[model samples]
Target: MTTKANFPVTAGSIVVPYGHVIGNEKWRGSEIAQRLQGKIRLIFEDGLGLVDFHLSNRTCILYISEADLVAGDEFKRRLVRFRNARSLGGIVIVERTQISDQYFLAVQKLVVLELGMVLLPVANQGEASQLITQLVREQSKDHNSNPFLRKQCSQLAEPSLFRTVQQIPGVGKTKALLLLQQFGSIHRLCNASVKELELVVGQTVAQQIYSFLCS
Candidate 1:
């Protein structure tokens, strides 16, 4: 019942082994833990404090039962404590049965909008187990496997480059085209000296371009 904001455990301090989930001892005999057995290795630990499950060093899960939702604002206060503790990236898994459905929106707003934590609704403990399996697998995979985390190969369009170059004072379509032709790219053009720019445009225009770019 002690929802202390100053819980000693922190996300950075906990080291979860690869491909394994460190679950709080409270979930040892629960349905979610039973279902997660074959899918991913689950290890139980005592005194996890505010966290229900540690998916990784940086991420953890806080589960809210139907009973918790029906009880009152205790879950909200617990979430607030967890958020204030700044322990980990808390992913809240809440029961969303017809009985608890009414409280979902309010819980979502507090968990996602106010506390800035991830909120996922499960119909029951069985569904919660499946979601936890997927999360554990995602955490175990190499970061490069994720498209968003992968290195992107970006190529700037010539039309966009031409338009950007023309934004410089005294630079029109003709001078922009000429500068691009001489320098090949905006990076090279920006590095070009006023003397170098004189070759593309006149001395006065070159000074203006140099000043516009440098300024």
Candidate 2:
């Protein structure tokens, strides 16, 4: 899984699987990748990482094909490890199909519930590019806001878990405090499912909260 020769690192550089560039039943060929080369950078990488793709700012993703899902327990085991590693802040999964029930449950448990990874069932590279763009923009906004807000800090203060939880969308200071009290820790709160979050914050806000945290 070595990277392609002469791959350039540029603005919005994203590492993609070598297989996708070679043309698969689902991905067709390098044409899609070539089309995207102008707007975004694409680097090829060996299968060293748990994720299939990676962004410059640490967003990683696993593109799970239907065949990968049907391959049995190996994928599930890897997913379990990937979830618990908590290596990246925001990760994603791009799948052609929704996946089988067993794999779907695994995704619900490992990716969505345990690891909090964004799951995108995209039909083509164009849709994937859009999601990637949205992720980069959101990450940029978070990165840019932190420093400016830090400069306005009155003094160096101890970090509060409540404040951290409030960073998730729809979780204001009040809801953040409540979540901390209910869950007892940030880890537990993040591990809670969207359904569980709905119990705390209601349906609409819960979905938004999950999307913000996972994305």
Candidate 3:
């Protein structure tokens, strides 16, 4: 029920050194902490409040045990409170054994769809530790080295734009070229009135294009 403001540590001000994870004092000597010892530096801290682990300044993890799932709606409320607080990007690490499997779909819908937070299910604390190690390593990597970022930066929009325009009924390379020259982009072309499109591709084709796009 409490907001992130109640936490003693400020997420914005907390700096997790590269390859290090700040863990809630409650996890001290626990399975996760013990498993993580050699893979990544684990620092125990007090007053993390609802957060179980801090992966970075902007990202944190919340662990949900099978017991928590069986106990009731308290875990859901905690997730909602953290989401409403918007203190950091929350990655929920939930224990998904046979018993907790029944609750998985509902929790997935609530965490990923309703609240828009990341949900990662693990068999137990040991698996959670492995996942945490990978996450920490990924965080330590340079932004440019990320495959997604590299792909986004390398992509050229022109090819896709031409392909999309050509998909319209009766539109070929020539008409597509004329449309691109006049409108410059698919967004502008889609919004063009029949009268406006007629200046480039004649009245009949213009109407067809308009109908195809609008319908």
Candidate 4:
């Protein structure tokens, strides 16, 4: 039997149930649903595996556990779906510590920077709601006037330096900004050394960044 349900309209918002629902007694399952009341047009979907919440702006927040993230080919395939989805501003992955190093590395190279998904490390699923809410708020604001949103919307249309630079191996949104400040351009940053990157970011992250550049 199909688990999918017709998108339900409540208080003028569309609530669609999309995935397999495994509920515990604690209401942890409906955390997004509760936190997002009256915020957007779409409802919190229970079935979406790649992203826990998809906003009206098409930005999605994915809350990943160790098991779901390390499913090898399956994981990569889901990421591909996120990449191909239309109207995507960006994707956010809320990470847990149980994720294996290999899976984390794959996500870093193939999913995050390449696909324009953001990586947010959270202590657990409980912390994802606030972050998701924050992203929704930011995205729902003025697109034309807000310089940040304007830039992000342009990024949604096509890859921009604001977004593309983050795809570099170990670089994230923050690190990407730092690299831009240090190197003044993506071209120069591409040739940056482990030592130079270390001075900007840190030793461990620099090593990872340099290794990814080399590969």
Candidate 5:
């Protein structure tokens, strides 16, 4: 349970999960249409579509009619708490839609099962579930498995670093992201001396960063 699970479990697969949305009245139609359009585009783009969503002003509104929401680093910023995200339109579409709490968890859980995290129940419901389970099990086995699958395996099919950066001193969300963008790797950035770090973060911050990392 502690090890992070991923999403999509596997390409071209899924189950009948529950879903709904809540949002502003003025923008509902536009938002719903946008969601549907995005689903269509994404399915064709990467064979993936909306899983679930909540209409709390806690997230940003993505418009497909005029504004582009795909690419340019698409992600659900988990660290930041968002609010006041009312959908702006004449129809009151989902200020938020297509992604719900359960769907997210389900996708991640399914990914974990795929990554050999745990053995779960047969979610197939009829012959489909049994067939899917068999296929997944046969595709991956604990012992004597293919080396490529283990070495190149990924959660939700997205690339991920095996180590956690949360415990790094002075490396909160913002700083961690800054380092990731600047240095492109944690080990390399951490290996920097105070003087070298100063070139990038200035004298005061460089010292603080070095001390925090070396600590």
Candidate 6:
């Protein structure tokens, strides 16, 4: 009984059911579906997307209560801990295709980074990280252009400019958090005017922020 999950249109043994992908079932169950839907397909997050799929009430992400939501809860919690645990973030390999159980188990064993990408767990599964690294290595031959993956191998940091702002008179934690959220980071806020800060915080506070950052 080949279900709608297995869309023949895509290809391979990948059978990602339309609704069950997210509905209130165990993540363990879906893990299998994400992998064996088909042969290797290329699923680009920017190139390919869920244009055909629509949300449904019966979806697993909806009705399940976390009280008994063992698998899902645990996965998310571990991910959060992983993110906060070390300076180097986790490596989440989000696949364009659904992920399968075998691959997931293999990934769990890999030297998982603190900040990783997410995988589809079903369709268009490919050796993404390997491919990306391969590309990076290839690009390294030039040495002129910036390396494709050369992020400042530093901590996920609050901008040093914020250290300056905090030193300014009258600025406090509440205002800092609010300002950071609105403008994104200190570098952005540094460019903003008193009026923009006012729009986010208020006229009075904006004046303070402006006067502070301006200096």
The alpha-carbon root-mean-square deviation between model 6 and the true structure, to one decimal in Å, is: 17.2
Off by over 4 Å in 5: 1-166
TM per prediction? 0.63, 0.49, 0.64, 0.55, 0.24, 0.26
Order of quality (lDDT): 3, 1, 4, 2, 6, 5
lDDT of 5: 0.31
Across 1-215, the per-residue lDDT of candidate 2 in tens digits comes to 21244443333343433222311123324434555454544555443345555543334555665576777666666666766664453344434554454465455445545554445555555666665545444443543443213331211110223344565667887786667556755457766889998888889988987776565
- The TM-score measured for candidate 5 stands at 0.24
RMSD to true structure for each model, in Å: 16.4, 9.9, 12.5, 8.2, 17.7, 17.2
Task: Report lDDT (CA) for all predictions.
Answer: 0.73, 0.51, 0.74, 0.52, 0.31, 0.35
Which runs in model 6 stand beyond 4 Å of their true positions? Answer: 1-155, 159-164
Model 2 lDDT on a 0 to 1 scale:
0.51
Model 4 Cα displacement at 142 (Å)? 5.2
**Cand. 3 Cα-lDDT:** 0.74
Model 3 scores a TM of: 0.64
Once fitted onto the true fold, the runs of candidate 3 whose alpha carbons sit more than 4 angstroms away are 1-8, 11-13, 150-215
lDDT of each residue in 144-205, candidate 3, tens digit only: 66422322121222333454467567788889788877876655776799999999999889
For residue 12, give model 2's deviation from the true position in Å. 22
Please identify which of the two predictions, 1 or 6, would achieve the higher TM-score against the true structure: 1
Q: Where does candidate 5 have its weakest 10-residue lDDT segment? A: 87-96
Over 1-215, each residue of candidate 4 has an lDDT whose tens digit, in order, gives 11223453222233333322222112333655454344433333344444545444334445555666665467677667766754454454535575454466566656444564556655555466565556555544455644333222332222234455675667788887777667754446657888999999999989987877567
Deviation in angstroms for 113 in model 3?
A: 0.4
Question: Residue 46 lDDT in model 4?
Answer: 44
